[model samples]
Target: MSDQPPRDSHVYDGPVGGWGSAKGIAAVARTARPGPGAFDTLRRQNKPGGMMCSSCAWAKPPNPHIVEFCENGAKATLWDLTSARCGPDFFASHSVSELSGWSEYDLELAGRLTHPLRYDAETDRYVAVDWDTAFAAIGQELQALDPKMVAFYASGKAGLEASFLYALYARAYGHVNLPDSSNMCHETTSVALKTVIGTPVGTCVFEDFDHCDMILHVGQNPGTNSPRMLHPLQQAANRGCCIVAINPLREKGLLEFANPQSPWQMTLGAPTEIADRYLQVRAGGDIAALTGIAKQVLALDRTQGGVLDHAFLDAHAHGLQDWMDWVDACDWAELEQVSGLTRDAMEAIGAIYARAKAVIGVYGMGLTQHVHGSDAVGALVNLLLLRGNIGRKGAGISPVRGHSNVQGQRTVGITEKPELVPNDALRDLFGIAPPMDEGWNTTAFVQALLDGKAQGFVGLGGNLARAVPDTDRVAAAWGRMPLTVHVATRLNRTHLMPGRSSWILPCLVRAEVDMQDGVNQQVTVEDSFSHIHGSIGKRSPASPHLMSETAIVARLAAATLPASAKMPWDHWARDYARIRALIEVVYPDDFHDFEARMNQPGGFYRGNPARNRDWQTDSGKAQFTRPAALDATGLGVGPGLYRLITLRSNDQFNTTVYGLSDRLRGIEGDRMLIMMSPDDMAAEGLVAERRIALTGAADDGIGRRVAGLRVIPYDLPRGCIAGYFPELNPLSPLSRCDLASDTPATKGIPVRLDLT
Candidate 1:
C-alpha cells in the first residue's frame, strides 16, 4: 500500500443526482459484487412490509417511489449484502497489528464477520470461540464489575427491538450508562428542541413537503447524507417553493438535482434547481446567521404588522417579547461580522420567510456539532416560532438524522439521562428497580475510560472508537479496559482496539434473514419523521454462526443477570412480539398496538403533541430562547488559525468509508486533504497539494495534531477550512463540547495549519 494520499483534485460542475448518482451506484455494485439477488433486494427498500434502507433516517414517503433507495442507500445495502466473508481463516492470515495499518475502507471491504472471536493475548490474534463461551465470558466480566462502571453503547443501525432489549438489560443490571450514536450527532437537537417545542423530534411529516411554501435548508448536504430527501427537494422546487440553503459550503445537492428514476430528466441532463438562493456562511456562524435572520423578521414585523404571527404567539407561546427585545438590541455590524453575511443577504432571506405562509427549517449535524449546537437549534426554533411554523401544516423544524433507526434507539429508551426512560413502567413490568442516576454521555464515557473509572463496555453496534473525538487518547483508554464486547455485522476499527479481554460477536445484518426458534422475524425502526415501521430481511445470512441483535441482547442479559431476576429473556428472544409488548408497556402512548401497527401498510406515525400546540414545557407553551451573543462558538481564530469544519465524503456514510472517491467534490482516491479558498492559500503562502499539519488551537494543554494532510484550494471562506471527519476528529478535544448537549464541537474547531 502506498503511503501518499491521493492528490487528484478538480472542480465538479455537474448536477448532483443524474448520471453521477447512477455511476456511483454502479461503482459500489462493482466493488460489492452483491450478485443478481441484490437488485431484487434494492427494489424492496422502503416498500411496505419490505426491507428498510440501512443508510439514513429519512422518512419513507406515504406514496413511495418504485426505487426508493438512493446512491448512499444502495451503497449501504450492497455493502451489507456482499458475498465476501471474513471467517477464522481470514483472521488467521492477518494479525490484528497488521490489519490495524489498513485503511477504514479496506478493513470493512475485507467482508462481513462470520463467527465469534475472542482476543488471545498470548498469540496476539483473535481465535474463534463458541457463542455460549463468548456470552459466558462477557457475562462473567460484567458480573465482576459494578453496573455503574459498565457502559452500554448502541449504534443507530440496530432495530428498536434490539435497542430496547439492550437498554433493558443495562437498566435491569442496575445502570443507566447507555451512551448511543445520538450522543455524538443529534443530541443537541434533542436537548434544545425539548426546551423550545416540548418535544425532542421534528414536527413535520413526509406530506409537509407538498404544502410548505418555503424550506430553509440550513447546514446540511442532502445529496450525500440523505439522498432520499432529494425527491422532496426536487418536488418542492418544481412546484415553485422557495428553497434557501444556508451553509459554509455550496453543496451540489442543494444547488441542483436530477431524478435518476426520471428518464426524461436523466436523458436531457436537465436537473431541477434545488436551492433558489445559497448563503455560504462561516463555520460556527449558524447561531449568528439565525439571529440575524430573526432580527430581519422582527424588523419586517415592526414595519408591517402582519409579518409576526401575533395570534399564535399570544395563544401558544411564551418569552416572545423578551427574545424580540434581545434581538432588537443586537447591532447589525456585530451580526454581520459574526455571521459572515451582509445585512442585505440576511434581509433577503428574511423577506422570503416573511412572504411564505408556511416555512420548514431543515438542518443536519453542521448546526448540531458546534460548541453552541444546542443554542443554534434554539435559535432556529425561535425564528420558526416568530412565524408560527410549529403546530401547523406545511411548517416546522426538521433535523435530518443520519443513521437508520437512530431515532428509534432513543425512542426505545437508549439514553444516559434517566428522565428520558420510563422507570416506573420498567419496574412494574420487569420487577426491577432501575437506577435513576444520570449516566455518562459519549464525552464523559471516554473520560471515565481514561480515568480508569469504567471497567467494561458493551457495543450493540457502531465504530465508537473512531466516531468520537480525541481518537488517540480514546484508543489508549479503550485498550486498558478490563473487558469490551462488540456485537456487529462486520469488522471495524473499534473491533481492532481490543481491551484486556475483548470479544467480537458476529450478528446478522439488516439484509440477512433473522430466524429465531424456526420462525422468521421482522424488526421495527423509527425514521426521522417519527414513523414506526417494520423491516423484514429478504436475503440469506452470510454465515450460520450469526445471531440477531435481539437474541444476543436477550441471551447476554440472561447470562449476566441473577437467577432471581423476573425477566423472561428466553421467551423474548424466541418471539420479538413479546419484546414489543414490553416496549408498549413502557411507552404506552407511542407503542400502543405495536405489533398490529408493524403489520400495517406503512406502519403508524408516532404522533408529536407539539404539532397540535400541546406544549409539555413547564409553562405549558412553546418558548423563544434568546442567544447570549451573536457568536455562539467562542473560538477566536487568529491570523494563522482557521475554523475547521469536518465533513463526510460522497463515498462515505457516518464513519463507514466505502471508497476513496468523493465524486461530488471531483476528488478521487483521497481522504487526507483539507479544503481551503484560493485567496486563503495565497495569503497563508500555501499551495495546493502542499503537505501541512493541523494542531488544535484550544487553550487546553493537551497537544492534539494531525500531520501529513494535503491542502486543496477550493471555494471556501477566507478563514474557514474543511476536511473529512474521523481523520480530523483528533483535533477536537474531548473537553471542548456543547455544555448543554455534551456533543463534541466537531463542526467548528479552531486549528492552526503549519507546513509539514
Candidate 2:
C-alpha cells in the first residue's frame, strides 16, 4: 500500500487568546473539516468599514443599543461574508457527478457563482450561460406546461417584493403550487391559530416581554435560532419576569445567555439567567405535559372558585363545553405515562400559570412538527384561554419564527391554501383573476415529484433538497423533472440536484445593494417582534455578474405570463414601491401606510387581533379543539421502542449548516449522535459512547434506517430520544406528518435502536 501522510491531530485545543475554547472549541472540532473562512469571518464582521448592525433589518441603528443582537445573527453575518468563493472555473473543471460526492459544507465553501450556468448532460458538465438565454429557456419550459404542473417554492430568505411578484406570477399563470418555508416551520400555527383567531399571525409584540410577569417558552431555543430574542429574554428575566422552559434538552442558552452587548458582560463574561423553571419533558410528550397542566389549572379554578377567567371565556371563546369535557375525560395514568412528569411537577407548573398576573406562551418547531401538532398547539392555546392569556397586555401566543421574512413572505400571498381571490382587488390592481383554488404545500409538492406528475420546479432562493425530509428519496424523485430553475445568492446543495435541464440564476445577497432603474432601492424585513425595518446592504456584491432577486423574478414573470393578463409586469422590475402599493391594496386595513411605515425608525406592528380581544372564529369566539390520544396498543409491544425528535444546533439553522458545533448541547463536532437517558441506554444493553442503528417503524411503504448513530447518555426522559435533523431525516418517513397540518412529525418518530 502507498504510504499516506499522517492525519492531522484529532484532538482540538482551545483557540488563541482563550476564546471559544470549551463549547466553541469542541463545536468547531466536531466538524469534518473547518471552513477556510471560519477564523477570519468574525474579524471581518467588525472591520474598520464593514457591514454593521446599523445596516441590518433586525436592528434599529439610530436607537441606543441594549443587547441588540444574538450569536446566531453574528454567525449568519460571518457566514455570508466569508472569504470563500467558487467561480466559473471551479464548475468548468468539476463534472456534476464529481461535485455530487462532496458534502454540503465543502460545496458551499467553494463559494459564490460568478455567472449563470446550464448543465449539458451529453458533455456531463455545466457551462456558463448569459442571462438572456437562461431566461428564455426557463420561459419556454414554463410556457409549454399547464401552469399548474409547475410548482413555485419560496424560501424565508426571499425579500417581500420578490415574494409578492412570485405570488402574482404563480396565481396569474393559474398555478397555485407555492410551497414555502412556512410549510416546514409554522404551518401548524397557521392552521390552529386561524381556526381560533381568524388570522395566522401571533398576538403578542416583542415589547410585551418587558411588561409580562411570566413567559412560557416551549421547544424554542432563542440562543441558537433567534439570538436577537435573547436580549428580550434576558431583559425579562432580569426584571423579575418568570421564565419557564419546557423542552427535552436542557439548552445552555436558555439556562444562561452571555450578552455580547454589555461592556461589563463582554469584559467580565457576564451571563444572564434565563429559565426560572426548566421542565425536561420526553420527546413527543409535549401534548400530554401541556394538557396535564391545563387539567390541573382547571381543577384548581374549581377548588378556588376563581382560577379561570370565566367571564373572558364566556364572552370571547367558543367550544368551551367540548374542551372541558375532553380535559375532564383524560385519564391521569395515560397523561402521566405520556408526559413523563410527576404529579407534583404538573401541579407546580399549573400553580405558576394560575398565579401569574400575565403570561406569554411562545413556541417553535417543537410544537408544530408532530403528528398532532395543530391539536397540540390548540391544547397550549386552551391552557392560555383558561387563564385568559390571549387578548391581554404582555400575555399571548408568540411563535418565534425562523428566517427574517418568513412570516412576511407568507403574509405577502405565498400560500398553497390562499383565501378566495379578491377579484375586485385583482382587477383594480392587475386587471385579471388570480388563481383562487388551493395548491400544493411542501409535502404535497414532494409527493407530486414521487408520482412523476410534476414536470418543473422554480425555487425562489432556498436549499429545498436539504430542507425537505428523505433527501435520498427526493433526490431520486427530482431526477424525473424536465426542468428546474433556481434563483439564489450562492451555490448550495439544491443547485447541484440536477434535472434534464437545470438553470442556476445568481442573485444579489440580502446584505448587498439592490439597484433598479438607475437607483439603489431599499427593501424591508419584518422581525420576530412584528416590527418592519428598512434594510440597505452596506457592502458590495460578491460579484458584479449577479442580478437582484426582484429583477430575476420579474424577468421570469414577464417571459411566462401572456400579454392579455393586463398586469404591469415590466414596471415591477424597474421599481419595488409599486409592489408595496399593490400590497397596501391587498391588505389595505393592515398595511395602510406601507410606504410611510417603511421610512419610519421603529417599525410598526401591522395587526394585533388579540389586543382588543377580537376573536374572529366562526362563532365570533376563540374555539378550543384537540385530537384523540395516540393508542398505547398501537405502540408496538416492546419496551425499547420510543419516539425520536430531531432538533437544530446552536451553530446551525434549518438545513443550512454553518459549522458542525452545537454549543448549547455540549456537543462539539458530531450531528449523528442520539441524546438518550442513561437508564434507557443501560436497559437496551447499549453503551454510552457506542454507535447504534435507528430503524423507523412502518409509515406508508417508506421505511428508513440511519446507522452509526453515536449514543450520548443525557438527562432526557425514558422512552424519549433526540437527534439532529437533516442527518436524522432519513429516519422520518414523509408520510409521518401531522394529519391536520401535513407537517412531518420530525419531533415524533416511532423507532427501534440496536448496537451497530
Runs with alpha carbons beyond 4 Å of true place in candidate 2: 1-67, 267-270, 420-423, 630-637
Which lDDT tens digits does candidate 2 get at residues 1-756?
A: 111112320112221112342334344333324244433333333222222332122333334354243455555654565555667788878988888887666776676667888988886777888888998888888888877778999988776788888888888878789998888878888888888777677888766677899888998776667666677788898899888888876666577765655656655755677888888776666788888888899888889878889899888888888878988898888777777677677778898889988899999887888877887788788888887898888899888887778877777788887573355676577765767778999999988888888889999888887778777788878867988999876677777778888989888775566778877876766755566665566556777888888889888888887765457777867888888888888878767899888756556677767567887778888888766653211233356678787888766767767676764555766678888877777788876678888988755666678898888776666787888877787777778677777877788778888664
Candidates in order have lDDT scores of 0.88, 0.73
Most accurate candidate by TM-score: 1
Q: Which candidate is the best by lDDT?
A: 1
Candidate 1, residues 182-214, lDDT tens digits: the string is 999899999999998899999998889899999
Residue 317, model 2, lDDT: 82
- In the predicted model 1, the residue pairs found to clash are none
Lowest lDDT sum, 10 consecutive residues, model 1, at 1-10
